[model samples]
Target: MTDFVEVDTAAGRVRGRWRPTTGTGRMPRSAAFLGIPFAEAPVGPLRFQAPVPKAPWEGVRDALEFAATAQRGDPGVTLIPEPSVPGESTLNVNVFTPDPDAAGLPVLVWIHGGGYFAGSPASAWYDGRNFNRDGVVTVSISYRLGFDGFGWIEDAPSNRGIRDWLLALEWVQQNIAAFGGDPSRVTIAGQSAGGGAVLTLLGMEKAQHLFHGVYAISGALADVSAERAEKFGRGLAAAGGVAPTVAGFSSLDEERVIALQKKATELGPSSLGSIVEEGLPLGPSVDGDLLVRPTRESLRAGVGADKPLVMGATDDEFTMAFSGVAKKLRWVPKAFLLNRLGMPKGAMRPYLAANQDALERGTAGIAGRLLTDRMFRTAVLNIAEDRGDAPTWLYRFSWPSGTFGFAEHCLDVPFFFDCLDGPAMVPLAGPNPPQALADQVHAAATSFIETGDPGWPVHEGDRGVVRVWDTPVSDVVDGYASVRALREPVS
Candidate 1:
């Protein structure tokens, strides 16, 4: 039988449900307080503003279901599954705890990824039950997305989504103790754009002391300049036929705003040539306030020097992203491919020698590899190098998803959450994925949350050791040398 429980939060009394543990007798059951509002709904006049704390409710608000996601396009187009629910209070968090009465347990806060445009905490793969069973209190959060969250508006706060993240962390600080979590022992983590969020937060002074450590999985860093942000915002306003301000956006119907945002994003590749040429659009911007500089520079200046961190990307971070597009590029000329990839014709010599089949496959494979290195892998390594003073553990998720030959982006998420069996994970993980890998990833993550270490030597100086998560997991120093050598310096 499911057990129902209630906890008094800063906002009001919330009713939650308890799901019995499916583990051995030693494992503890977990309580789930879902759809707990951490901030006021960013709707109507509040839209595009920094998150405000939700007003206190009267009594016994049902916290039994996931909240609605921020406005987004259909999720079917993305590799990761994004389940949408319906509600206005998208600035909410889901808390899973071993025992609501227990105190001082470590807390793990998760931010879901959707390319800064889509995704929600309601995805089945994000269930925090396994975390609770392991004696950790897990909190998964939802924030604004797409134009509503990241779009730059003249009258609205920049990085509103990031602001939502900070507000949620503040909420955790204020209320997690009642859910059996120690606010002082918080570790924030995210995958893909969420992972980017982790790194972004690390670089922000506003995020100081919010969490003791962080995990960035397949993190992709994309920061737009104010000029670029304003240009994109103006274009979005033009597309929507509204003034380039929060008031104009607020006056439009919510669905109409979402539709226009979708159109703007779809036009990003052609309209926002500067960012699209670099394979990025409508993400975090250097707003000169919350994020005073680029994230890498901020880290180099010691923004996150005190926190322990675990950061890495998959071997083929963009394999899934390139799957369909690659197939269509088979007939494209090699010279054009070389030019587009910023590599001279003979530059393919080393890659060709490494993969004999690359020639037959044309530039698709090479392009995917280059994109992976430039967009994800190099960014992660750069962060590691800059934050060398901190206790940082690096990793490479090499286990391939059966659907894609390489370790695709978002593939490691289920393993990290130990939710491979979640309904939405089957296609990504395949049936009968290696449970052993899941155990190793989950154990290491739980260990990090509890003690700020992930069972590996700290990466230091030139000889940075990296944990390779694959069959027969092993550690190697400077494993990224080949790709790093080929990587162009960040612009």
Candidate 2:
């Protein structure tokens, strides 16, 4: 039997469906309002500008299915299963709540990750059933991706994707009360690129009012420099046979634009080494207008010092990429690879000496660990350190996956969502993922959203503590000490 419900929003009336949430922490009366437009379709004249508010409509619109995603088709880039739904109305939000009549519940708004180029809000893994059951309203949102979102143009506004996020959060503030949520208590969270989004928002003065707390899992910051962004933008325009302006780009087919942008960043055999060394070409750029400064600089200058933040990275994020190439890398000198990764000449020996265990796994293992630290862990330390005395918490997902034998990237997301049984989870989390670990992660996240703290001690000073999530969770002082070498000033 189908159960139907309706709610009124600032835009219009929306009809959603109710369903039962089951399993270890199951609850009843959870309802979902999927595909609610937070902004007008970013097509035609709105293609390269900031998001426009969705025009109000009459009668109750059915929000039963997921909306169009910014990612065109299945790109198979990410481990999470984010299906692509095609349409112009890609700027949408999916809401899951326990009750529409109930009030004052905290709201969690999620942003999916794909290096700011590709990712979907339609993933089954991102379902808010579990969160709704826990007395919180969950909302997963969609934003523009790739060149369309972040690429620089001669006359177009920069950081269109970021603007999409702000508008969606504004929508939550204006309309979430109808879904029984407290807009004042909104907590923003995401994984990987989405995690990067959380940190970006944390440091953004314009975003401070939209969200109060943040949970950034394996956050990857891109803060692309204006020079690099301009270079890449020019290269992309040349490849597309168009000018770097709205007039020229508007001439080419959308498919041509996508192909040309991809061509600008495509990796070949030789470029693989520089993957983490050279930062991403497209993402939240340090535009002079909206983003007046780099994310770290903003944080260091006491920006967003008042918000509570919980952030962590998996033990071996991005290491699995090297699992099969160990033999090929056997003969290559580790020092050469380290140099190629932009490591300082003097720090190579010390960095290797500090990671003796990884050294035992040979050159491939060392390379993987270096890449992991350079790309993920080191940033976690830098952000925590930059925050100083602010309410910040650090953690490490040290539990190795049963299948891959390493605590890889994107592995902790299902655990964070507490959706162990969601689609495609087994392939990443192994056949039997521990129920208890999910419980711990989810509970801590919930606590952070509902309250301010995430259970463990707040990070304090240089040797702050980090909560390590393994089979038997433990809190270690200076848990990120291994990465201090990367933090050392290069001679």
Winning candidate number (lDDT):
2
Instruction: Write model 1 residue lDDT over 98-117, tens digit each, in one string.
Output: 88899999999999887888
lDDT per residue (tens digit) for residues 139-232 in model 2: 9999999999999998999999999999999999999999999999999999999999999999888898999899999998888989989898
Clashing pairs in 2: none
> In candidate 1, what residue range of length 10 has the lowest lDDT sum?
267-276
lDDT of 1: 0.80
State each model's CA lDDT, in order.
Answer: 0.80, 0.89
What TM-score do all the candidates reach, one by one? Answer: 0.93, 0.97
| TM-score of model 2 vs. true structure | 0.97
Clashing pairs in 1: none
